[model samples]
Target: MISSYSEYKSYLEQDRIALGVRNDHFSSKIKDFLFPNYIWRFEQTLRKLEYYYNCKNSFWSKPTYYYLKYKFRKISIKLGFSIPINVFGPGLAIVHYGTIVVNTNARIGKNCRIHACTNIGASGGTSHAPQIGDNVYIAPGAKIYGKINVANNCAIGANAVVNKSFEETGILIAGNPAKKIKEIDIKKIIKHI
Candidate 1:
């Protein structure tokens, strides 16, 4: 359970390190703290939150869902301006604190790391969402738009703009219009981690 902003920040830092990003700009202590209940209930409520945040096209019949999600949103807005997507499997690990926008249509996989200033959205009028695979590491300021499929074990470099489909694994993608930089040795990164 995250008790304070510092704890949240620490989690983000650990996630970044695990993703092999050598940086340390995510540290900040929490002062004038409020919302103690959120700290206690975060872990318990996380699963349900992820469900609601992910099922964009589905509607729930239960009243409890609405109440709990409403309360959670209120607390989240008060604590910080984070709108966490209801992603499946452990939720998304935010590596930095900033205005990050993830579209409701976008589908992300488990254990994905999203840095600050990243925008994951759809193209003009297209309902087909971006299907992202597991263990993908997206760098800060990257913009991924359209109904692109990013395969598992891929690293999206900083400020890259990805709008195409990639089927290859263990590659580094970079540039305004992202292209494969080189095939990474996933074993090396795993060993380093």
Candidate 2:
């Protein structure tokens, strides 16, 4: 959620750093554009549209926001991501571009490194989605749903189905009903966060 220009810039910078983009300049940007890390492009458009929609009410903002929203939808469809705006905080790292579906109601905190085939959604089409904390690592093929609250610095392993909440932080949760496997140093896993 970008409410101001400075906040938008800061969030963009944090997102770049989270994605391991070291430099920001004309040349580097041109290179990235040419090579096209689609995820970066998606995030850039997402931030821009969010900023325009949230902060501005001028005439130009409306058309620009709609156009960017169209572009954002195209990119997301191409990347197989269904993440909605304002759902994720700053420093979100999507590790791959495949089958990452998040509910519109889910609220994930900053510094979340989520892998492909992960679904953070509500159950039975209800609005009871998960509220995940900061610096969490959601591994590939994980399915976390319902009205659960995952603590900060938590790691959800691959293919784990988490339906319940885990209040303890700095723990690794795995297995089909997802339990605390062990306590881990989250920094070791989410290095960018």
lDDT digits (tens) for residues 103-144 of candidate 1: 777777756766777888889988766788877878888888
Tell me how far the alpha carbon of residue 77 in candidate 2 is from the true structure, in angstroms, after superposition: 0.9
lDDT of candidate 2 over 132-191, digit per residue (tens): 999999999999999999999999999999999999999999999899999999999989
| Residue clash pairs of candidate 1 | 53-86, 54-86
Cα displacement (angstroms), candidate 1, residue 103, comes to 1.6
Residue pairs in collision within model 2: none
Taking all chains together, the TM-score of candidate 2 against the true structure is 0.95
* Best candidate (score: lDDT): 2
Off by over 4 Å in 1: 1-46, 51-63, 75-88, 186-193
Clashes of each: 2, 0
